[model samples]
Target: MPYRKYSELAELVEMMSMAVTSGRFMNKLDDGTYYNLQDSYETFPVKKFENAKKSYAQGIEEDEELLFLFDITLFGSATDGMIITNKKIYFKDFLEDPECIDYVEIDKIIDRKISDEECEMTLCHKGKATKIKIPRFQFFDHHFIQFIAGYAEILQQNNHLLAQGKAVLKDGVDNITDIIFDAFWNGKKVEKIR
Candidate 1:
């Protein structure tokens, strides 16, 4: 049986290709008006995040780590934002307060094309649904987001297959010749296909 070790959440964030800037520079630009995920590394602005954290996250569980933070902001105003962590995810919007869910609790990741320029990702848990507007950063970034939406499922399947002595993850991983992201990326074919 094969197993992969996860040392930290940043590894997954990198897998998603999320553009996170250390707060040292971006903060001077935003002038620290708002906070981004804002970790110890100052991934974004952190000075204001403490307040937001108290209002929203209130600190995650001991073993949990924040993996991603996305907010739909226009001219610096945010209607909502989402935070993905090692164990679960949290969402907060104008309609409601912050909500959290475990990774395994996610039942499906539904993606829909809204138009030539827009698309949305929906996470369905049990019977309820939460929608996230995929940020258009580049030509193919959305696919990574789509994959991140199913991180739990992907890891589970890969580990399960490895436990069964299957090397699908290895084969795909070998195709990449990398130590990480073998299970998540499978191979470069995904990039060529898209």
Candidate 2:
């Protein structure tokens, strides 16, 4: 995976850190492009990851158009073994454990925090708080880091809106109960904790 390349991941993370600290906000335009609204004065178009997993069900590849749409909707947010679509977040067992790949709806995420060293995500389901953390050194994946940073923005925005009593889309939540479930568990049949 590209993220396993530590130098590449480190470089990318460093760039992102700079981008964040530069006091410029990356605004996504309606035409699937992004531009810096503050100081950097940069503009770029969205790029799709050809190596993205085509599907959660083995042997089924994701369509290029669909993947492109996913990238545009999520602003090129993706990583090996993990994908954040408009409706849900899908993930595979990268640890080679005996668990099944699964997904969580986008509406389920509640809050999250992304720091330089780690990402702490908090999910609320059935009146319970589920937390998931990804440490930087242990899993040097670009997609994971990107997701943490990008989704952190959405999570914070949604959280702020909620505090103001506004309705917002589901953005970031730590709903993955077990990173490793039964291998036979398919992407379907995921249920909220009712």
Candidate 3:
């Protein structure tokens, strides 16, 4: 799916009922794609992972697009995962209450590379900083850090478009590539698909 819309968070969580055969958990992005897996993977019976979706989706805004979500704990407790929208980052720390940090309020983000598999990000805002350890997909492959650096601008653009009642379309993440003479190569510039 290039982009997914769920009226309720439960709808989104239900689709993620599939058991990962190769990866630990599902990670998704807004560019109309998901990393580490695809749509065809087999699913567990709906009853298997149903109720926990409620706890997970509690903090999500009704109209905000869920740009990314990742499971971060062994138990699907109150503090089990993190979500990133264009406006803010929502996450939970172990045994802590669900929290939200708006991008517009952030002053800085210090990303510490823990390893190739994961990282620790300290979100500094309102004279306080909260550190959250997250997966490494956002570093090289997903451009998450790049997005954070520009989210203030992104939020401004979104608000401007909203004020004008205009729609917005975002680009997805993929290796920039080209086919020249029937051979594949990384392209220097990103060109429109059409």
What total of clashing residue pairs does each candidate reach?
A: 0, 4, 2
Q: Is candidate 1 or candidate 3 better by lDDT?
A: 1
Can you rank all candidates by lDDT, best first? 1, 3, 2
Residues forming the 10-long window of minimal summed lDDT in candidate 1: 24-33
- Give the poorly placed runs of model 1, Cα more than 4 Å off: 1-15, 18-44, 73-79, 114-119, 139-141, 158-194
Instruction: Note the Cα lDDT for every prediction shown.
Output: 0.48, 0.34, 0.43
* Residue 5 Cα positional deviation in candidate 3, in Å, after optimal superposition: 29
In terms of lDDT, the poorest run of 10 residues in model 3 is: 173-182
Tens digits of per-residue lDDT for model 2, 100-180: 211331235445666666555654544565554443322332344454443343444445555766533332232221211
Q: List the residue pairs that clash in candidate 3.
A: 2-32, 31-172
Candidate with maximal TM-score? 1
Selected candidate, larger lDDT, 1 vs 2 = 1
Compute the lDDT for candidate 1. 0.48
After superposition, the stretches of candidate 2 with alpha carbons farther than 4 Å from their true spots are 1-51, 54-81, 96-111, 125-194
Question: For residues 32-134, could you state the per-residue lDDT of candidate 3 as single tens digits?
Answer: 1122212235342232122223544455566454444555555433235566654467766557666788776777777644566665677788899888665
Q: How displaced is residue 173 in candidate 3, in Å?
A: 21
TM-score of each: 0.53, 0.27, 0.50
